[model samples]
Target: MGLLVGLVLTVIGFFLSVLAFVLWIWMLIDCLKNEPSVGNDKIIWALVIIFLNGIGALIYYLVRRPERIKQTGQ
Candidate 1:
């Protein structure tokens, strides 16, 4: 029973790590591509994402990302 529990925990840990890595990469790319409207420069945001890891990406998404608009044609 203990062995099976250990294996399951290990698999869960591995999956979480992979998810974090993907989120980090996606946020890094998005940060690089978008220009910040109010906060620091692009280089700074990029560095934050690189150094602070997943937390930095979460911060960027919550604090810095711009609002989207819908365009209408007449």
Candidate 2:
């Protein structure tokens, strides 16, 4: 039972670490993207994601950046 619990916890821990890594990579990618001439919002979001990690990425991707990019057509 203890071994099983440890294995489950280990898997959970691994997934969490992977999640953090993915968020950082996504932020780095966002940072590298060229900003649209019409807007600074995506660039701002990229910085926010870089600073705030997962939560920032979530908000930037879900709330702010999509509309901005759509408006820019880039």
Candidate 3:
């Protein structure tokens, strides 16, 4: 029972890690393509996503992305 529970937890952890990585990559690409390059917004957001990984991606998703989409009408 103990071994089975440990295995299940490990598998869950692995899948969650993969999901976080995918989210990070998706956010990075979204920033690169959609973020305006007028000033340093693109570069900054890209750096944030790269350096901060999952947390940064989540921040962007919850904050900037919606605002950007609303502003750009895309």
Cα lDDT of model 2 by residue, 1-74, tens digit: 99999999999999998997797777557645744535775567677887888877777668656675676664
Best candidate, TM-score-wise? 3
For all candidates in order, the CA lDDT equals 0.77, 0.72, 0.93
Encode model 3's per-residue lDDT on 1-74: one tens digit a residue. 99999999999999999999999999999999999888999899998988999999999989999999998964
Candidate 2 ranges beyond 4 A from true positions: 37-43
lDDT of 1 by residue, 1-74 (tens): 99999999999999999998998998898877755544667788889989999999888777766431111110
| Superior by TM-score: candidate 1 or candidate 3 | 3
The pairs that clash in candidate 1 are none
lDDT of 2 at 13: 97
RMSD each, Å: 4.6, 2.5, 0.7
Best by lDDT: 3
Q: Give the higher-TM-score candidate: 1 or 2.
A: 1
Q: Provide the lDDT at 72 for model 2.
A: 64
